[model samples]
Target: MAVYTHLGSERLAELIASYDVGELVSAKGIAEGISNSNWLIETTGRDGTGARYVLTMYERRIDVTDLPFFLGLLDHLAAEGCAVPATIHDRDGAACREVEGKAVALIEFLPGVSPSEPSPAQAHSAGRALARVHLAGTRYPHTRQNPLTAENSAGILARFSESRLAGIDPDLPATAARASDIARQMLGGLPESIIHSDLFPDNVLMLGDEVSGLIDFYFAANGAMAYDLAVTHAAWAFDPRGETIDAAVGRALVAGYESVRPLSAEERAALPLLAQAGCLRFVASRTEDWFDTPGDALVRRKDPMEFARRLEFYRDAGQGAFA
Candidate 1:
């Protein structure tokens, strides 16, 4: 979440007034992610209690028409007892409101802290939570395609000149090309479901090895469940720079996920390639963000090479990475 649009105090108060949530006490901008403007909203509750909510202004990378699918998924997941926050509908029962012609949502503020360096037990809990999400979403009525696939990544990279890509790193273009080839050959017949394609550590809130909440479902989509596990494994089992893998953490995460939902033999066989796809997806987006993001944007620029190294690791380790 980032702040591209700055709504002043009066505008924020007016926006809060549209809902019965209560009078706005404060709105603080969140500056972690790349896609949207987010704020931590605090308010005086209707019951004289204090309440907090996360307000997200749809910025880039999200289409306005997809609001229902995104926000509704949150409500659906929450209803199914997944550790996900719900969308707070306005007095008119709308899940989102338009602010300056952009769609904005008020999400239920859940408790817990995002783990920085997660423990093995925390990784286990997060895995279990993700598995639960896949199982719960089986009956969800709507379906949306995964937008950030390996092919999509390759296409995005194709638009960039080789020189521009090389500017990030000399080997980036070759790495991305290799990724595209693997993507085309990604195994079929794998199980698919609603997936939180982006389950990085920052997206998970944990308290004492238990997953308290899973936030930021913007990248959530209908996709391969094993691929989602691969994404989580690639995300959680790496060092900050993505230079090394923690085998213990990797084992714990896969163990935790399988504890809730066992992987099919086909899914197990596909993991190494799926993990590579996960890395490629990040490499593509981060490469774009690296060159495209403005110098003064409130969002932080992530290194594309971090995932490049990860892709290399997955390629060399093969299925042993999962084992």
Candidate 2:
């Protein structure tokens, strides 16, 4: 979702030629996300008709060995009729190809824009789609652990000096400590499934108020399904700075999700703490990216304080936030 690595027009054309997707007509670098280098690629099409696709070059935060799980998940979801983009296999039937030392893959481009400010109806549809994804992913045999957890994130937070954390926000250091403690106390024994742990607003594609596609499964893993719901709830129910909660949006999202697959009592009771974990996970990672991502990197460095604010809200609101 970012252009950390630059591949010029000629080099891009060479890469596209390896696939049966047709000669590359044009390639434009996408600069929204931070993990991988992405391009919106257009081609003459395998049958002479034109087509568009997303080309992602694995940069960091992803293990090359885990490529099969990520790419295969897309194919599985697509075949199951979930609105997920399928991976474009190469002429050799390979899911991805290596360029130099980096791995790259072409994804079927799904139409629809990412909503900056989603409405209740949109949130409802997105929630339904997410539930469908969780249900469909049950048959996907591969399992990958959720790498971004409270305990693991505590290690990342430990790397920052007091001054560095204070520079971001005076409250950040305390927020990190509180997040770790809350996550540790709120143990999990709830329903488990393959969850899209990072279903941010940007990761969902919508046409009007209906969700057309759910993108960005890079963070998908085998985890508590309620934790996934909590992640989505935390992501959609707040303002940009996590300062205000959209009450109607929150209610609609849970309602929509329950319409497909109702939450168990344990999942309902555990939601607030799970939401806190979601917020803290972002806070720790964003704090790291704030200090580490290159100045000229073709991606926007998100403010860690946004999620820090959210962590505080979850702490204060308890189950009332979701209610």
List runs of model 2 lying over 4 Å from the truth: 158-164, 293-301
Top TM-score: which candidate number? Answer: 1
TM-score of each: 0.92, 0.91
lDDT of 2 by residue, 79-150 (tens): 999999999998899999998789999999999999999999999999899999999999999999988887
Per-model CA lDDT versus the true structure: 0.89, 0.89
**Global lDDT of model 1:** 0.89
Which pairs of residues collide in model 2? none
Ten-residue stretch with the least lDDT total in model 2: 179-188
Candidate 1: pairs in clash? 1-33
lDDT of 1 at 282: 90
> Using alpha carbons, what is the TM-score of model 1?
0.92
Q: Identify the runs in model 1 with alpha carbons over 4 angstroms from their true place.
A: 159-164, 293-300
